[model samples]
Target: MSIRANLDVVHERIARACLKSGRDPAEVTLVAVSKTFPLERLQAAADQGQMVFGENKAQELDEKATAWTSSDVEWHFIGHLQRNKAPVVARHADVFHALDSVRLARALDRRLEEENRTLRCLVQVNVSGEQSKFGLDPSALAPFLEEVAQFERLRIEGLMTLAAPTDDPEHVRPQFSLLRSLLSTPAPGGNTRLRALSMGMSGDFEVAIEEGATHVRVGSAIFGNRSYQ
Candidate 1:
């Protein structure tokens, strides 16, 4: 199927999910994960009215942002970002979804201050407790949010998490629920009224939406599989 066709199907699913959960479809933002896909794929999705794109690497996001240069194409840095690469991500990304540490947050904040810019960021929580995932432990979120609040240039938007990869989407429902619960809980010493829950992907977004996901990052469903360079 064409990218536009796939997007229609995805949007239909999102709408149905929202209807099932008694929520507005507008409450959920679909972020097309465009990492490893070519500019042509992005152009195709953009032609179909997709404005938000998520890239996993800072370098790739910088390259793509420079190549596209469309003010309408809002880029999101959604992968594990390194402190050294914080400057690039801070300069180009409109929203960041994998802020898991104070060091990384400080780095990004410093760079944003220098650039005279402010960034919207989601604190990533490792709810599944997977050794392979890159996020802060759930128990540490409160203190982490407190520390992060000190950074003036970084705005704490909400929380983000990657569910445990499983064949049955139901297996990861608890993880999504946990993220929602965290978002609802008041953070210490900060008004962390998280408005965005960046959970879900192409395979399990419906379940995530039912559990209260405000942002879903979908890739293969829209752009097909990754084309490695």
Candidate 2:
């Protein structure tokens, strides 16, 4: 299937999921995960009306951002960001999805301040308690949010998480639900109205959408399998 065809199917699935959950389809944003894919593939999706693209590596994101100058094309840095690469991400990404530490948050905040820009960020949580995943533990989320609030340039948009990889999508439902439940817990400074849940990937996005995912990151479903050189 073509990228456009795959995107159409994904959109249809999202709509059905939203209908099942009594939510508006507009509440969900499809972030095509373009990480490890070529720029031409991204451009192909863009031509099909895809505006938001996610990259896992800061260097790849920077290179793509440098090449695609369209104001309509919004880039999201959805990888485990390193502190040293904060400057590149701060300069080019419209949204940072894997903010897991206060130290990284402080680093990104400083860089955003230097660039004179404010970035919308989602605090990533390791809901499945997977040792291999990169996110804050559930118990540490509230304090992390409190500390994150101190950064003026980084707007705390909401939460993000990668469900433990499993063949059955039902196995990951609880993880998504847990992340949703944490959003309502009041932060230290009484700011707890988070509006986005950046959960779900190509395989489990439908389930994530049903469980209240505002943003879904889909890669292979849209662009097909990635090629690692």
Q: Cα deviation of 186 in candidate 2 (Å)?
A: 0.8
Scored by lDDT, model 1 comes in at 0.91
Local distance difference test values of all predictions, in order: 0.91, 0.90
Candidate 2, residue 2: how far the Cα is off, in Å: 1.1
State the lDDT of candidate 1 residue by residue for 1-229, as single tens digits.
9998999999999999999999999999999999999888999899989999999987888889999966888898999988999999889999999999899988998999899998999999999999999998988888888888888888888999999999899999999999999986566534355779999999999999999999999999998887675
**Model 1 misplaced stretches (Cα beyond 4 Å):** 188-192
lDDT of 2 by residue, 7-28 (tens): 9999999999999999999999
The residue ranges of model 2 lying beyond 4 angstroms of the native Cα positions read: 188-193
